[model samples]
Target: MKIVRSKEFLGARAWDAQLIAAMQDATVRLHWTDQPYPWHVNDGQEVFAVLDGEVAMHYREHGRELVAHLGAGDIFYAAEGDAHSAHPLGQARILVIERAGSV
Candidate 1:
């Protein structure tokens, strides 16, 4: 067994991650970033949970762009084909669960 620290976690670079689990087709990953990610559509569903700091989540729905300010403990669910992006406020750690190779 292993313990994973989610809060107050920091990494050297953006998108840095710790792989927690890998299944046949799905994986659970934790990441740290201080930059904004390019908007993209996920191949399948995605679960994003904030563990440290904050993230400005940007998403487009029906051609309309929206932004949500997410803090620690907030979760973002991205459905298949849902286009979205995340811009970290300073430094932040995120827990992600999605299809393997989806990054």
Candidate 2:
């Protein structure tokens, strides 16, 4: 398996929002590691899979951090209007899927 570190904070703050593309279509894949970001709910649906390590996903509507400790083969999905953030709890690799033109 390929391992990717979270480079989201490389040239910005820990809270800076960054999105790394994986697969873009009706389903879009984005990867992130070593950082936390804030996001707002848009028009498309999204799915998150932890390719490696652990991450804490916070959703605005939930009002709590969904500390998703994902490893290989783990997955999570968030629907439309689900405002959230992707945060690396450790050295993490996450796969995010969303619709095109939604971000």
Candidate 1 residue-wise lDDT, 23-79, digit = tens: 899999999998999999999999999988899999998899999999999999999
lDDT of each candidate versus the true structure:
0.91, 0.62
Model 2: lDDT equals: 0.62
Candidate 1: pairs in clash? none
Q: How high a TM-score does candidate 2 get? A: 0.62
lDDT of 2 by residue, 3-103 (tens): 44553333333332245554546644445456766667757787777766677676655575455555666786778877777667766656666786677
Which prediction has the highest TM-score against the true structure? 1
| Segments in model 2 whose C-alpha atoms lie over 4 Å from true places | 1-27, 62-68
Give the lowest summed-lDDT range of ten residues in model 2. Answer: 8-17
Q: Candidates' TM-scores?
A: 0.93, 0.62
The residue-level lDDT of candidate 1 at 49 comes to 96
